[model samples]
Target: MIPAINIDAALAALTDHWSPKVVARVNDQYVKVAKLKGEFVWHRHDDEDELFQVVRGRLRLQFEDGGETVLEPGELCVIPRGVMHRPVAEEECAILLVETVTTKHTGDVETPRSRSIAEQLA
Candidate 1:
């Protein structure tokens, strides 16, 4: 049975930056919690839109077209599929990510920060 999943507890269990842990699943998407800081590589999923919810601190989503969006607690944003973007957090930030189960953490450009679905599930 899927028990009640606590976001705070789920976030607290995370110990790495840019690494997402699967906390729940709704239909074809995976609900994940991650601790983030610094800057992530610029990449885009070819066919999956990615959702980010700011749970703590702040997040800056930078786009390839020189645009950006800052997210505060309780704020969420969705990056449409195929949009090149990168995530940066000046300080440690906690966030919830919702995306298809097949979505790669860093899209096609694999970096040291990339986390596989199997790794996320573990």
Candidate 2:
């Protein structure tokens, strides 16, 4: 049976900055939420594409190729596998991330700034 998803209930569970809260799963994918501020690390997933949806804030995704896109509330974007991208925000914002179970939030590039994918899944 498919689990019911209550957006309000899910959003209520999130209470940290940049820490993702997993709320739903579809196949090998997870629907995750987090509060973003400042900047994230540049990373890439070799085998999974990622989707980013802004729920209550704005975010800017910077690509290694020197291009970037700002995702406003209600807008979303997909980041392809093996591409380097970093998420940045000017202030506190809510965001939902969708990706395969194997996809890392920080991709292959690890740094102190990288939020552990496992931790987020929990």
The sequence of per-residue lDDT tens digits that candidate 1 reaches over residues 23-99 is 99999999999999999999999999999999999999999999999999999999999999999999999999999
In candidate 2, which residue ranges exceed 4 Å CA deviation?
1-3, 113-118
Q: Which 10 consecutive positions of candidate 1 have the poorest summed lDDT?
A: 108-117
Best by TM-score: 1
- What does candidate 2's lDDT look like per residue over 84-120, in tens digits? 8889999988888898987766778766656676687
lDDT of 2 at 6: 78
Question: RMSD in angstroms, candidate 2?
Answer: 1.8
Please give the CA lDDT of all the candidate structures.
0.96, 0.84
Alpha carbon lDDT of residue 10, candidate 1?
Answer: 90
Off by over 4 Å in 1: none
| TM-score to true structure, per model | 0.97, 0.88
Clashing pairs in 1: none
